[model samples]
Target chain A: MIFPALRVLVPVALVIALVAIGLRIGDALGIGPDPAFTLLAGALFGVLLQRSRFCFYCILRELFEDRDSRASYGLLVALAVGSLGYVAMFGSWVADPGAGRLPPDAHIGPVSWVLVVAGLAFGIGMTLSGSCISAHLYRLGEGSVLSPFALVGALAGFVLGFASWDHLYVETISRAPTEWLPARFGYGGAVLLQLAVLGALALLLMRRLPARPARDAAAWRLRAVLDAVFVRRWPAWVGGAGVGMLGFIAYFRTSPLGVTAELGSRARTLAERLDLIPGRLAGLDGFSGCATVVIDALMTENGVFILALVAGSLAAAIGAGAFRPRRQPLHRYPLALLGGVLMGWGAMVALGCTVGVLLSGISAFALSGWVFGAAVVAGVWVSLAVRNRVRMRLSARHPAG
Target chain B: MSTLSKSLRRTAALLLALPLLAAGQAVADGPVVSTSWLAERLGDERIRVVEVSVEPGRFERGHIPGAVNFRWHTDLVDPVRRDIASPEAFSKLVSEAGIDADTTVVLYGDHNNWFAAWGAWIFDLYGHDNVVLLDGGRDKWQRENREMSRRPARHAATDYQLDVAKPELRARLADVLEVVEGEHRAALLDIRSPAEFEGRIFAPPGIQELAIRAGHIPGAKNVPWDRVVRDDGTFRDTEELRRLYADIGIDGSDPVIVYCRIGERSAHSWFVLSRILGYEARQYDGSWTEWGNAVGVPIDNPAGTVWGGT
Candidate 1:
């Protein structure tokens, strides 16, 4: 009885304390109400994310590993919806598309072979770590032991990325052209091209929908709504819409929706404070990435959003009675750490993760997004093949076990 | 389970309170400003916004309402020599743009603001009073849904008096050679790509910016010029910038000389180091073109065993 009560009390206390702290910091910084609003918005996003399990890792895992693509449609819907939002915001600029003047700060990077390497590494990392950066944040709320390690590894990866960026940027990234679809095809053409591709994929996935249980003839449909909203799984379409709308709202209200930048920022700040990193990293401040430095390190818009995201997930998990901790083998911890390293490095080099690069980038009509997405899929396929081989080998060695 | 639950609740409460304990104002008022900052001060009388781009008509298409166009290649660069324009020519360019000595020129453009930084470096070279790079360049402004106009700006040309061109602001081939010979203890910053540092490929695959031989200056560290900025083309905060260079042993105390293929990319670094971080830094405009081609000068080729042939 006490444990159950503690769950409710703890999250409530956390929300109140966090809000108070956020407000205090905002006041101190003279940023007014921006931090508080972002905090609350982040919480909402977290709740939606937790309730729907809107994770890139899980979606891709199900698609490739389980031979199920139902959840994958959520991502497609997100892109489709997000692309429309971007079009609405960027329609005027797209009216005149020139090679020299592509839409700026849209997460579109130079299309290069490095993208394939980054994607492959990210896929391997996701498989090993069991979650993407965004997924890990929500999972941390539900008390996943592996998330913290993965995040730490991601931080380390960012540092490593900085170390190696000189070679990558000068050699590979500079060699390739930044391919923005709108620059070549114009805004309408690019949006239509993207929609057609996404729509076709969505239609194909719809045909492969999992069989649903027959409804009781006398039971009301509203009865199922509660289960969908609270206890049971949400339909792919609902999750898709929810995630899509959230992405749109995030971009509309603040900057692009990204989780890794904040992670990188905290890591860089901590490392700098500890004197672990260089006093001046050569040319690191200028290039565009999700991990741009913030004025208020502790109470940045992204930081608040990330915190609320975890809190929101915790709330949802407790409410749904799904906050139970899972038992795992000791070996999984080390493996997860290794996975985290790969994820951090991959995301750092790729300039964003699945959410930042694949979703947000494509939505902005950046060809780098398409390149990353394709590479990630290929990586996932390769990793699945390797996993299957390993599993088969293990079974062959110990048939009884 | 009860003990675990109790501890979890305590941890949650503590985590929530962490923000209140946080302190320090990480931002500093300096050369870089956000689109919002510039937007608020858009029509200020003392500020002059200059749109620098390689592409023609980019400013004509849409720009910050009052910004004048500065064609970096045609206007800033000397049409004759592979060098920045003469002081007299630069004076004419800025004076025509309605900028005087005290005018705070905010430079912004596309192409990762490379040309803008180049413009900023040129202004600093001639000792312009206040020159700044618009953080994230025009992209951030556009992304934020800020106001833009197609009307070409016209201003009363002022006789902007330029101070004597500071030769110390620039690193000549002789200075680079001194570092190469180990006579001077300075950080040689090669802002070129790694492949260029190594003798793998000459210029970027497409562009004509190339050297006769590949590789970096001896003792020069390869810190690609793009590393100093975020993906949106904004300079990183001071702390981040400090650690980035410190990590590479560029603590800003030692005199640093930055260079690239033809000095365009390195100019961006020079701006960041000298203007943003206040480092004792200089840009070697001759860069690889001079270093890579000059006879009898030592070159460090990482890709192959060969030194300098051509």
Candidate 2:
């Protein structure tokens, strides 16, 4: 009883303490109240994420590895809800696309062949690292040993991405189009198009989702809120809806929901300050991609947001008695690190991670989102095949096991 | 309840309640006005709204009820030289637009207010006393679901007199060269993409490369023009803008000359520095087109080689 209570208490106390400390630091640095807002938003994101397990990698792995598409349906639900919210907020632009105006600050980036390559690398990285960037944050909160190594690797990958950005950008990205659907199709047409596509995908995935057992009276009652919050994994649809709502709220209140901006900027700033990278990072500030620049202060809105995400996830995990920290084999650390580097590089090149590029990007009616999403799935397919082949060979070599 | 569980409950409540407790408004009065502010003052005889979007149809389709169209290319530029309209021509345009010396001219547009800022810069150059930009521009108004009208509101022509043009507020190629060579006491800021600044890529695809070579002015610090604004196209608070420029060693100690490919993007930065941050800043309208092509002038092409011939 004491252990269970302590587990819950410790995470909550730590999160509050961290947030308070962050606010104080932000105050000293003169960033104002944005840090507090970001941290709270992050914590909320973490709680929702921990309870739902709404990770891109996990969802994809379930679909491919277990032939279960429930999580895939969850992703579709999220897209559908997010698109509706975007439409409501951005209705004016949607109503009049002839204005030739696109929504400012949306996750839309330039569509190029470089994006496809980046998505593929991101997929491979996600597989090797065992989680996407957001997932890694939440999972790290739950004491996942592999996350630290993956994060470090991602930092290294950002440096690599920064270094190679000039060459790739000059050749491929410079030629690509940054198309918004509402610009080509009217706002109504774009919304209808997204809804139809998402609806069809949901139907397709629904057929593959396994049936569930009947729930008891207590499970259906008001007590279910508590049960769902602290004792059970939320249904995929609920998780998806929650995430979409959060994304909508975050966009309206602050910036669009993104996890990589802080990481990318930090890495870029650190590298440039250390003289490891050049002062001018080409095309980074001009166009909409995972853009990073050095700011005067150490703590940014994104940094606070991400930190709070981890805290929220920790609280949720501990409350639900799911804060399991498992040790990994020493050899796996290297692979995790490599995976992180690839993810970092891909995310930077692509301008966002899975959620940032695919989810938020799509919701904003950008075609780049679809392109990145398709490329990532394709990359995952190829990596899975290669991994399976390697595993088979290794098994054959050690038949005694 | 157990001690741990009780404490956890209190912590959760405190975390949720913190936002409410941290209450203070940062009333930043930049050279900007909200949609509501404009709405309340709309149709007032003294307030004139000028829409300066790149797309021509936007003004035709609908706009902030009574905004006059100020096409950056056709209306704002001089036909003979690749420069802003002559003071006489600008005076006529402003007069035609019914913007007198005392009139409160509010400018707005799309593409993150790129052209709007350009219009504001030209107005400032001509020394307009009361000029302001709509924060977040036309997008913000539309997003707010405010009233829009297709019926153009024409204003009677007024004699818009200019005593003198503020040439000091507008940096020429020569002024930029001085700042670049460190001969002048000013901050030379290149507000272009990193690739463009580093000479990795010339112009973005589709646009003709203005400069014979891809690069930036020497000793000019690169600060991507978009840093001063939020995702919603609205400029950040004054405190944030102050810190961003300060971090890059850009204080109000010396004047700042901002430039981009054609001076449009840099004008946005100029608005931020001069209007928002209240700094002594100017836009180099000649920008890369003049800098990159000029003979005997210095060009810092780090990645690509500069062309030898004209």
Candidate 3:
């Protein structure tokens, strides 16, 4: 009954409450707060994401494993639009200004070996966990009892991550530097290089041959075209571009692109405030806090956009009647849990996840993106190898999971 | 809508050739429900009340009628796996709590419903679609002058099914390690305090002899958990939640991992960001204890950082 008035009213009301609380807490903590507008946008995004399912894990799985690369369309659209917007605003934010490389926060870090390694771990983990970090949250909204374990596991990985810092800094990423940006290629060259790559990849991935191969595609389905107009549908090339653009726009708005940092950083502050976690870890006490340091963190326009994607998804899923709360398999939870652990550990090691390092990095022309992307593929393959070996061992004669 | 408004809408649709999509308010199953709605529902037999709480003994003191106790940690997970309970175990456990496949579990708890929503998260993880977290949880329930039962109720157990088709939803230890190593797909998030993050002096309650060097992972940022929730236990406004994350450098787009010491405190945050807020996020199960205890992994102490040798 109240849905009509609630949309605008709720957001406004929520905004008021948010500002009041933010100011109150900022004063007590003695930390200067960022402008409320950005914060409000972020909150709306949170609400949107919870409602939608704009998650990289969901989209990626749908693309590669399921051959249903529709969800990623929204991300691509976001990237395309955001990219143009970012390019328009890049000068004020960059050191060289002319380099198409707007900055680190716009897209992914760039191509790198470790990035691929970490991506593989995260990808496999999502397979096992049944929900990526973001999806895991929405699942919570719908009432899931198992997400907490992933949380516990992630924390453990972070703590354990301390044990691996030296290797991470030295062996894993001693040379993982930004790549592909205008800084390296110069403005025109960088733009041309990116366009060339995206165009080629899109062409190959989206090739269409005999319609008989895919029944869905065989039929002259108006739904596909309609979906393009209304919702995300087939041939996610355009969507991928959008996502890339969104990554571009994110940093142009004056902050880096990311998701885990805001939540993770907040978790740290909460633990400190409550005395649950020790006041120090990794030597940079105040360096990583949301109160004092915003640069190193990943929260910003992209955070809010994340929510918008979710909301957009929610709108689509609900509209399509495909929104059903599901029950995950019991036997597979061990794998899911372990996968989650790996994702946490890998995210810890890599300093970002697929969305941060791969998607954001790639869009930003950072070398880390390629590295993580490739690493993730390799990691998944390694998992396949392990699975193969495990099957061999478990069933010398008769095999199974 | 009025005739003029409807006419304008029609005109815009015909002229623009764009879908006139409308998204209603994102309604919770129950958002800030009144005390009366809750009271009436309490007597309904179809509503199975479950007290999913943090800490021990609280359920015994007083609880909603017919509610069973489910600890946020010990009762739901295999102490070692970094994800949700095994479906086999979850089915058995939830059933033991008297939850049937269709049972609508109305969960509540002590502080701002962290454990309660967490309980809800568990149900979702197990494929239960009918679970609900009581707004205000026990605190608001009590403040609203609702009744409480001091005696523990004798309840029956029911079955639950956690489908395995969605196994790709979680993050694993390797995933966390990858982030630490700066692999880059998804990053490990340390939602510990600044001190804990820096390895200055965090030994979660009983985690003595953390002989491992003290510090957070090199790239992990420290955002406390409660920033996601409010002081009164209700969730902060959506915008507040957004800013909280942004300030901490967390954008909703990237793959994110949230963690705390035992994951209980951090569970609150996981609930807020991933659950309530809907970011593609997961929680670290083992937390610091498991992380710091191992050798040759990774560690970042506070600025005065130190690492325990392998």
lDDT (Cα, tens digit) per residue for candidate 2, span B1-310: 8999999999999999785444321121447888877887777767889999975446655688878887787788875788787778888888988878778888999888899999888888778847889999987887788998856677999997764468788888778777767788898899999988998877864365768878988888898988888988888889998999998899989899889998888999999998888899988888998888898898888886565433
What is the Cα-based lDDT of residue B91 in candidate 2? 84
Compose the digit string of candidate 3's lDDT tens values, residues B176-196: 888777776665577777767
Question: TM-score for model 3?
Answer: 0.43
Candidate 1 global TM-score? 0.58
Which order, best to worst by DockQ?
A: 2, 1, 3
Best by TM-score: 2
| Candidate number with the higher DockQ (2 or 3) | 2
Each candidate: chain B TM-score:
0.86, 0.87, 0.77
Q: TM-score for each prediction?
A: 0.58, 0.67, 0.43
Q: What share of the true interface contacts does candidate 2 keep?
A: 0.00
- Fnat per predicted structure, each in turn: 0.00, 0.00, 0.00
lDDT of 1 at A98: 58
TM-score of chain A of each: 0.89, 0.93, 0.65
Give the worst 10-residue stretch by lDDT in candidate 3 chain A: A285-294
Compute the lDDT of residue B268 as modeled in candidate 1: 85
